[model samples]
Target: MAVLAVVSVAGLIVDDRVLVGAPIWAKSLKFSVSFVAYCLTLAWMLQFLTRRRKLGWWAGTVVAVTGAIEMVIITGQVIRGRRSHFNHQTPFDSALYNVMAGTVAVLWLATLILAVLLFRSTIADRASARAVRIGAVLGLAGAGLGFLMTQPTPGQMRGTSDIVGAHSVGVPDGGPSMPLTGWSTTGGDLRIPHFVGMHALQLIPLALMGLVALGARVPRLRDERIRAHLVAVAGAVYAAVLALLTWQALRGQPLVHPDGATLAAAALIAAGAALGSIAALRRPVGGNRAGTPERTRQPVG
Candidate 1:
């Protein structure tokens, strides 16, 4: 996928062709890079599942294979200068879309299986374990957002044959999009939240890394209990943000133009996260972390 992304980058620079109002190679690059992240993250995460490790490995394989298929179809569509998602202009296109949808369903189910395994397993680090569990759930939810986009728009439902669904709300796709992402700027865009939510798996872990580094300098944060509490707080905030983005998108509100209600909800989420963090930090640090459950040293596939 990384190699494909490199090719896509070159294509973007040399090819002037446009599809769906974006660079022809743009979606190819985006999906390829995203698959790289998704697959690599899943591979890293599967190592944590000491219990049902075999099942976890199988699930990861399913995710990787399906993801590869999705990328292939997307790139194939790009080469043909046709949009990959929601393109029902011809029988062939529709069949390809159906196949892609089937593969994605399999991938989603595999991811869910992996989530269950992770929840059943334990990690030595409480904070990491918590982060992993929460991240898995959020990641599933985020990826689930893709299904929301598959539903036909109101207009499509009313009367449409060439197209079946849309990612943009209150506006047609391929129109007035945000640069780079091609997200709708004129109205609500489901893709915005979808992107944000799907990355929780990586983002949460990355946040944990940052917190660990911070702990080296801050004496109080050195307590494992304290770090775990802070991680939980961060996870809560991240979940809230995901929910906020989803709500904003569904309301037909552009990300750049959040309504008063959206702003209020965001403010509440921020305030809640702040209070939660403070409460966590003020609590007494407990028990020696050396007695914590031991995490096995395992090589990532």
Candidate 2:
């Protein structure tokens, strides 16, 4: 993770621009490289945790698949420049990028489906399961809405200053037009929905963790005794913060503006540590046999 972070920072320094002016190939390459590096780091961390706990393999698999799709998309973008076959560009690059994007979208849908399945299994209890299911449904719906927002509106194609931005690269004169709004063109293209949708992947999982943690506190749930209450609560708080950020994005708020996402994330991290300490104190101290009931011998009497 540290290595990826360093690489991403280095890429940002080298690019020295946001989403514009850089050659199409260079821009795509940089973005994809940074994104893939980050995703892989996250996947590794999640895998490590899952291995230790022996839980949530399915969730880990979803994360791994998501990372793989991200890599493939980045590869296609880096190789293909900005043009695709359907957009009237050269067939090879265009076809590959288009196919890659389509495949990614499909995989994203599958990820959502798998999340629902995992939620069901993890929650187990009826009420907790229902809460998780609702959160998953909201996340999927939000993603669909965001996808629609990525398409070019009819009026947007004709002319609009809103499409222009500080970092936009205009299409080469007479070059093949991009069918999508932000990718093929330049300007103030609203990508808020896309941002929201992508973060949903994180938000949904965190929400599930929260639900599970809360369920553990319930008197009736068997899994309530499971360690990790703090982890679950911390996850829930983090998810809530992400959801707020998503709401801000959906409202077209600027990313850098103070919306409290950072503070919230920090708080959650601190709380997680505290909760973890508390949970550790409550854990069973000895081997399984020590906690099991001792049977008395009857034959001697």
Candidate 3:
């Protein structure tokens, strides 16, 4: 994580010249910084998920190495004024791109495996466990969306085989985009849901932590049963929102230019979240234990 942070800072300090498509350094810089935080957070969670110390170490090592390689390739391409993703212009570039794809595949598999292990095992903190489980599921779904970006859109391959499809739906790749992130403002950008889904690992856990803090201050909020229900409801709502964004993008609608359908979907998601929260407050949180009832455990440390 420290190494990635240094790379991120260097990327920011470098010249902001456009490379093959966009401001190359900015993309690398942003991803590097965000990924650094992501890696550390995942590592922290993995510790609580498994009792096998060596297995945890190995998993973390693989993630660190693959992530660093990914960052290196992206930054390296930026320095060469070339596109790192979907660049099949030359044999060398294609090989580099293929390597990155493999690295990400491995990382994804490892993460999914860890998530499975987490789900099968019992953790001390129900709230945190639920958060991790939900986060992993959403994160994988988001990563799966990357496959859509790789396929060539109809008519996109007619002009140039060097480029396949794009993250944008109606807009061409490298066309008019949102500031900094470069998501299409005129059309659906698949990256929107992809980005949103990937961060569930962090967001869901953070939400649970916030609840824990609130419980610390408010006497009524101190019940673990209620906290567990709240966390579960929050996860459900988060997943629903993620699904809504994906649906919006698939319908070829830009996030900023939501149509009536998008508005309606958003409203439905909000209402569902609100109702779920209400139900959580009214129900016994720890009563359900994989269909078997267990006495409420002590509050998690």
Candidate 4:
């Protein structure tokens, strides 16, 4: 995937061809970069598993293999100067797209398997364990959001054989999109929320680590119970944001251009999340006695 990133950059520089109004190599680069992150995250996460090490290892490979296959088709389509997704102009294109869809579905299932295993695993840190579990579930939801784009749209239902589905709603694909991400700027784009949700697996856990590092100076944050409580609050906020983005896109609202109702709902979610965080942080460090540090638990595995 790293090599693909470099090659994709070169292609973007040398190849002037445009597909779907974006640079030909842009999609390939995006997928390559995403897959790199996805695989590395799973690799890091699988280490926490105890008795299911063999199954976890195998499922991890499934994710990597399926991801690589999808990337191959995406890059191959780019090389052929064709749109990869929802493009059914040719029989070959349709088949390749179907293959991509199948591989993604399989990868999603593999992730689900890993999530189940994670529940039974022994993670040493109280805060880290809770963050990982919450992150996995939320990330799964985000990854599943991609399927919403695969269904035939109203226009497609009215009668188009050249395409099956689209990523944009209230407008067709290849229209005005956000820079780099290609999220529809003129209409609701599912890709924005999908991207946001999928990365929470890394983001939430990374935030927990950041708090751990900050705990050295902020003595109140050093309590294990406080850290765990904070993680719960952060997880709740992450889930709420994911829900909001999904709702926004389904209503055909762009991420940046939320209407009054959308804005109101967002404000409500924000206010609630803020309150939750404040409450979590303000709790008395009661779990440990005065002047005694909380003992870290050894890995149960």
Candidate 5:
């Protein structure tokens, strides 16, 4: 919530048009929100580990390193913008951003590895384990795809005259202007992949919930029912966000194409949630047995 508040306040204070033009505050706010979310997730996972089974300390360390790298990137961008005399671009800023992005990619890969290990250790039912595995795969795939799809081409960094023209809209040469929607593809096209990746936070947890719920219905797994229900409801909400993301992708979106891939992913997540829910519901109660000999002997006399 603090992170959200920062984003909201900064967004309001910063001129929307200037903010759209690779503004420092905007980037800072984004980093803050992402970092906060990451922290909260890590905290929850750590708590789970402590109460249930313990995950390696290395996982927490890796997360901390990644968070630190991200902070450096955000700080570098902020500093660069502040120090620029007459809108001069600094090589240091560009290099720091690249380094930060590269580090994040590495961290994401590490996260996938850790998630896989956790999945292996998870003694939960098939549904919960499957959800964790799927989420990890998605994160890994998204990062890999992003790196492959966005390879920088020659002359990619060269600024266009149109950018200067667009940046000049409704503002004095040095003053802030009204935020325009389409001019560059930096923020626009990037939204797709970012949205797809981030939504996993919701999708994965929810999937686990559904799994727990299903497991709870089984006589042997019934003890885990409460955990299952909670996770399933969470997964449902995440699935809804995935639907919204699909819509965002479809409109010839710049950063991330709302294409077949996005739709396919959404379908897969929805299917998992549905199947898990069904499995949970079908789980036999203690008093109301299933596949018993007594029931099979019915109508014999």
Candidate 6:
């Protein structure tokens, strides 16, 4: 992870010039940093899942190798002064793109397997367990959205272009973008949901950790089940929001824009998720505290 972080920084410096409007290595740098963070978060969650079984080592290895392959392809393409994604300019480029896509598919499969393991395992802190499970599920959903980005836009299919798709809807690729993320500011960008969904592994667990810390400071929140319920609710709502974003982008609506339809949908999703969470809180999944050993119990953070 540390090595990847260093490589990400080096990419930013080496490819300082703008290639397709954005810095040449911008995508490479972003992928590198995101994967590094991903590796750390996955390793942390695996610690819990692997306590009873050793399958985590194999899953982690798959994750590490896939991530490394993706970074290599992205960085290699950037260094060659071409787009890393959606490019089919040459036979070699097409093959490279397909290989990277295959690697990502493998990574997602490994993640799903690990998530299932985490869900079935018994843990002292049910809250952390639930958070990890929800994170893994949402992360996979987000990754599934990547397929939408692979399809060509209506206009692109009509043209004789090497690349089949573009990230931006209304705006052309390599046009105006948001600062660090390079997300389209002038048009709907499918990458928004992809980015949001990919980070659930980190965000959900972090939110749970925050609750755990707060519970330590407050008397009423000492019950780990209460924290678990809250985390579950947050996860539900987070999933709804990701779906909403994907819907909005598909409609060619920019992230900053919110029409009456979008606002109404968001409100409905929030209410539905909240109601679901409340119902689940009443019926806890794991048995009440008796099975969990004292040595196994620890602060979620």
Best-fitting candidate, scored by lDDT: 4
lDDT of 6 by residue, 76-147 (tens): 887688777888999999999999889999998988888888887776687777888899888888888888
**TM-score of each predicted structure versus truth:** 0.94, 0.43, 0.90, 0.95, 0.56, 0.88
Among the numbered candidates, top TM-score falls to: 4
Give per-residue CA lDDT, model 2, range 1-301, as digits (tens). Answer: 2343354456545644432333343434444554454344334323223122334455545555654565555534434444321232345554555565575566556546444454534342333333334444544554554344434444446665233122111222222223422332322222434444444444544543554555547422223233233334434544454455545444434444434764575576567657764664465532345577423211100
Deviation in Å, model 6, residue 133 alpha carbon: 0.6
What candidate 3 gets wrong by more than 4 Å, as runs, is: 1-14, 51-53, 284-301
User: What is the alpha-carbon lDDT of model 1 when measured against the actual structure?
Assistant: 0.85
TM-score between model 5 and native? 0.56
Candidate 3 per-residue lDDT, tens place, 1-301, comes to 4665576567667766776356657667677876776687777777665556566567767877888899889888887888888889899999999999899888888777777777876777676678878888888888778777888877766676887657888667777778878888788889998888888888888887788778768544556667777888888888888888888888778889999988998899889888988887776534465776656444433
Whole-model Cα lDDT of every candidate shown, in order: 0.85, 0.43, 0.77, 0.87, 0.47, 0.80
Q: Which stretches of candidate 2 lie over 4 Å from their true place?
A: 1-6, 15-63, 75-88, 122-135, 155-190, 200-301
Candidate 4 — which residues are off by over 4 angstroms?
286-301
Q: lDDT score, residue 256, model 6?
A: 77
Backbone clash pairs for candidate 2 read 84-94, 85-94, 163-187, 163-188, 164-187, 164-188, 165-187
Report the number of clashing residue pairs per model: 0, 7, 0, 0, 11, 0
Q: Per-residue lDDT of 1-301 in model 1, one digit per residue for the tens?
A: 9999999999999989997778999988998899899888888888788798888888998898898898889989988988789989999999989999999999999999999999898787777887787888889999999899999889888886688878888888888987788888888999988898889989988877777778768766766667778888888898899999988888888999998999999999889988998998897655444755533222122
Report the candidate with higher lDDT, 4 versus 6: 4
Angstrom error of the Cα, residue 156, model 1: value is 0.9
